[model samples]
Target: MIISRTPLRVSFCGGGSDLPAFYREHGGAVLSMSLARYVYLSMHEYFQSDGYILKYSRVETPKTLGEIEHRILRQVFEDYGIRGVDFNSSADVPAGTGLGSSSAFTVGLLNLCNAYQGRYEGRTTLAAKACEIELGKLGEPIGKQDQYGCALGGLNFIEFHPDDSVTCESVPITQAMRERLEAGLVMFYLGGTRSASEVLRKQSEQVKNSKRALGSMQAMVRQARSLRAEIMSDVDLIGPYLHEAWQRKRSLADGITNPRIDEAYERAMAAGATGGKLLGAGDAGFLLVYAPDEARAQVCAALPDCKAYDVRFDSIGTTIIYSD
Candidate 1:
């Protein structure tokens, strides 16, 4: 049996710019961090069958890659030439929560496959292969940040060049700075979930049509780069940077925010959150609050319907939990 685990991610800035529709023309950049929460995959050989068994939150089946209907999963297995394997997958969080759960699952499963074949792939290779399977093969309207963030598993600055090359660098900060950032971050679960594909499709269409949204997206990427530098330098003004990025991000798509989301953001701010943004596609997912440690409890109390999760930065991206 072989088990692999990969961390989910929270994209801090430069969310929309990673889409090929935007990046292929103007390039892309993103600042993100992976959390301790993870997606786990367990794969083993089956003596009696020449097929695959797959499992996730609400889906379970045994079949070939061509037989599976889930676009991402099917493409991944096909690209990896995986067959005759019994694979069971699961995650700590549900999908469509803006936590990059799908990417984490993909990275973890691919890593397990590599281990099964006696191939040890590094984080960059694993991430790049996952991207090739998803973006290149599946043609999903998504960004590179998800795959890289899941594979690298830390606070990262990712730059995508026009030539389709990506560069990922870990953000360096002192222990004191790390502690301060952790104390100020408050994550609350919103009441619903959203389809990222639906949101991203709209953004892609707009960008393809030469809309102002693309320009705004580029601006946001630049802001993210600036904010990342400040955070790495241990600057105390990270909250305002988050606020600026959030304001620009909301302009990318109309469905990114709703009445309930607005109410939650307002309440969090009133309760002492320095700045906050709705994570993921915006119709539903998590609201990330930036505040001092003293203000976290009050912020959580203000939003009684939401559950708060205490998460820290995860430095390890993906790893083999066990193999034999």
Candidate 2:
């Protein structure tokens, strides 16, 4: 048996710029951090010799890799020539909550498959392979941030070059600053699950037509870089910086925010949240906010409909937790 665990991520700024539509021409960057929450994957030999059993929110028994209904599992199993195995998965958060759960799942699965195959690849290779499976093979209309974020497992500034190369640099934050940042930040579940594909697809198409939108995305990249630098010196800058990024983010696509999200943000701001934004590609998921000590209560009280989470940053990336 083999089990792998990976941390989900919270992207602070710079999102749309990572899409190939924009980055292939102008490059991109995102500042994000992994949380203690994780997606866990476990695999073992199946009792049956000629079939595979998979379990998650649902169960599937397929005689062939091609017969698997889950896309990432199917691709990973085929890539590794894995069969006659029973695979199970569990997570700290559900998918589509804007915490990069899908990428964490992919990274964890790849890590488990590598261990099962006795391959000792590092985080970089694992991230690259996962990206290849999701982006190059599956053709997901997403950016490279999540894969790298889940694999690297720290506060990072990730850069996506036009040449399709990615680089992750740890944010130079002091221990005190890290604690301060974590304390002031709050995540509230705004409900509903959304597949980022449609919004991302629309944003991708619009980038080619709207220079203004593309420019805004480019500016976001700069914001990501600046935020990383500024946060090291003063964590308090994050709130206003997040606000600035959020303003530009909503402009990239029409469906990124809806009436409910707008009302929530208004309420949060009224209650003392310095700034905040909907996590993920928008429409639904968690709403992340920056509220200082005095404002935290009011902010939480204002969002009566949303569930709150007190999550801390995680430094370890994906790891094989159990094996035999």
Candidate 3:
């Protein structure tokens, strides 16, 4: 049996600009961090039959890859020439919570397949293959940030170039700064989930049509760069940076925020949160708020309906925890 674990991600800024629709023309950059939460995959040979068995939120047994119902898994298994294995997956959080669950899954699966074949692949290769499978083969209208974030781990500043090349570098910060930043931030589950594809599809069209939104996204990319610099020196700027990013992000698409989300933001700010934003493409997901440790209680108390999730930064990317 071999088990692979990959961390999910929280995109801090530069959310929309990574989309090919935008970056292919203007290029893009994102700043994000991988969370301690993870998606795990365990696979072992199934010699009882000459077919494949898969299990996740559901179960599937297919004689051929063409018969697999899960689109991502089908494409990956076919690409890797994998068969006759019992594959099971579990995650720390559900999909569509804006934490890059899907990308975590894809990266983990790719790692598992490579390990199964007695092959070793580096992070860049793994990330690239995962991106090709999802963005190229699966045709998801998404960006490149999540795959690289999940594969590379850490707090990364990722750049997507028009030539389809990506560069990921660690955001420089002291351990003390990292700890303080993690402590000052809180994530509240606002309930419900959203389809990222639906959100990204709209945002992609908007990126091509609306100059205002496009300009906002460009400003956001700059914000991500500035945030990277600020966090290393002045940690206090985190909150205001999040505030600025959220304001620009909501303008990229319509459903990114609604009345309820707006009200929650107001309440959080009133309760002591200096700044915050929806973690993913919005609509629904965890709301990440920045406040001093002393103010977290007030923020939590103000949003009595939401649950505060405790998480820290993860430095390890997609890894095989067990192999035999």
Candidate 4:
């Protein structure tokens, strides 16, 4: 049996820019950090060995590689020539809640498969393979941020170049600053789950035609750069920076924010949140906020309808937790 775990991420700023539609021409960057929340995958030989058994939110037993049901599992398992094994997956947070859970799952799965094959794939290659599998192979209309962020683990500034190349650089932050960030960062479950594809698809289409979308995303990339520069100088501009980015983010796409999300953000602000943004492709998911010590109570109390979480950073990207 082998199990691998990967941390989900919170995209701090610069999101829409990572889409190939924009980045392929103009390049893009995103600043994000991994959260302690994780997605885990476990694999072991099946008792009967008549077929392959897969367990996640649902269960499946497929006799052949082509018969595998879960798209990611099917792809990864087939590539690794996995069969006659029982594979089980689970997560710390529900999938598609905008914490980059899907990519984390793919990364964890890749880690597990590599170990199972008695091969070692470093974090960068693991991330690259994930992007290849998710975006290249699966044709997911998403950006490269999540895959890199999940695999690299720490706070990072990820860049997507025009030539389809990418890079991840750790933002040097003091432990005191890290703790401050962890304490001030708050997340509220705004409810429901959403597949990022539709939203991202729309955003990508707009980037080719709408200068507004492109401009907003480009500015968000600058926000990421500014944050990276300013963050190291004993300055915490994250809250207000998020505020600025959120303003631009909503304008980049139609479904990025809705009435309910708008109402919640307003309420949070009224309760003293410096700034907050929706976590995922929008519609529904968690709303992340930065509220200082004094306003934390008001921020938590104001959102009566949502469940809250304290943000903790994850440094290790993906790893094999147990094997026997």
Candidate 3 lDDT, tens digit per residue, 183-239?
888898888888899899999998889999889989999999888877888777989
Whole-model lDDT, model 3: 0.90
Number of colliding residue pairs in each model:
0, 0, 0, 0
* Candidate 1 colliding pairs: none
TM-score of each: 0.94, 0.98, 0.98, 0.98
- Deviation of model 4 at 22, angstroms: 0.9
- Model 3 alpha-carbon drift over 4 Å, by segment: none
The C-alpha stretches of model 2 lying farther than 4 A from their native spots are none
Tens digit per residue, CA lDDT, model 1, 1-324: 999999998887888888888888988888889898989899888654776666665554655567887676677667677777777777888889999887787788789988988989899998988888778887767778899999997789999888899999888888898888888897899877777988988877876775677778888889778877888775456667677778877877778888888899899989988887888766888888888877888998999998999868889999999998
Among all windows of ten consecutive residues in candidate 1, which has the lowest summed lDDT?
55-64
The local lDDT score (0 to 100) that residue 26 gets in candidate 2 is: 92
Candidate 1 structure, TM-score to reference = 0.94
- Candidate 3, after superposition: displacement of residue 111 in Å? 0.4
For model 2, residues 1-324, the per-residue Cα lDDT tens digits are 999999999899998777888888999999989899999999998999799999999999999888999999999988989989999999998899888898899989999999998998899889989889989999999988889999998899999999999998988788888888889899999889999988999999888899898888888999998988888888889899889999999988898999988899989999998988888898999989999888988999998888888758999989998999
Q: lDDT winner between 1 and 4, please give it.
A: 4
